[model samples]
Target: MIQKIPPGPVTMSDWNFVIVEYQGHVVEKFLGYYYELQHIRFSSQVIEYDPQSNTGKTWSGSKYFFLDRPGPLYPLAQIYLAHFSRNEGIRVRLKYQG
Candidate 1:
């Protein structure tokens, strides 16, 4: 089934999949929404963001992750695979709902 992103910053239950270049491979990570803030925590790094701005970045271990958080003010990211795609990478198609 498809998931819908709310028309604003995710509350305390929204989730978005993130793709990162880690260890010479593209890894897909699932980030959970908690508190009134938007933060994605990796193994040793935490990407913080302002819901209004919808953007975040963090450097963890030997990898760095930067993303434009999907929400109301911005377009949502379409996850091709919920799991890590080492070959396909992160495939996302933008669709306009009008």
Candidate 2:
């Protein structure tokens, strides 16, 4: 389900939520905060998307793991909208690799 964010100022840490189905089943979820830094570099090749921008932007030198599951589809993405502030919002992007 896709949801639009309301207008207001919100903190980064307060923008996490869970995904539920019609029968109240939790498909997947995440907990984290977004930050705006002058510069950030990672040690691994794969890093998650920046919540602020909805683009497929990636940082170099980052280390992260891809969570996956066994299914007919090899990979799938679950996207969530996280509002950090009324003017600034982020999309919590999740990719299922297993």
Candidate 3:
């Protein structure tokens, strides 16, 4: 389901209620307070979005990884609001079993 995030801060509690479903299956199930957003960076080819072509181009540089965020999991959602604010080209999707 595509959800629109309202303007304002998104608390951890709000993230807990967000169930990331893809292909009619639950992919990311938040674990209340236990779930945390982790960020990482490494040397790699950077991929930038080309709005004109609606495609990505890889450039030489360090790559940054923002993990456990909503934008990557739900790309259709508006990113200017709350947890959907990340505009980075790189992201990591992790399934927490804890």
Name the lDDT value of residue 60 in candidate 3.
Answer: 39
Ranking by TM-score: 1, 2, 3
| Residue pairs in candidate 2 whose N, alpha carbon or C atoms collide under 3 angstroms | 8-86, 42-61, 42-62, 43-61, 44-61, 44-62, 44-63, 68-97, 68-98, 69-98
Judged by TM-score, which candidate is best? 1
TM-scores, all models, native as reference: 0.24, 0.18, 0.18
lDDT of each: 0.36, 0.26, 0.27
TM-score of 2: 0.18
Candidate 2: tens digits of C-alpha lDDT, residues 52-88: 4421222332222223221212111211232321222
Candidate order by decreasing lDDT: 1, 3, 2
Which structure is stronger by lDDT: 2 or 3? 3
Clash pairs of candidate 3?
none
lDDT (10s digit) by residue, model 1, range 1-98? 33433223333333344555645655444354433434422222334544565443433422222243443122222233233243563442212122
Candidate with more favorable, higher TM-score: 1 or 2: 1
TM-score of 3: 0.18
C-alpha lDDT (0 to 100) for residue 73 of candidate 1: 20
**Clashes in candidate 2: how many?**
10
- What's model 1's overall lDDT? 0.36
Error of 1 at 67 (Å): 22
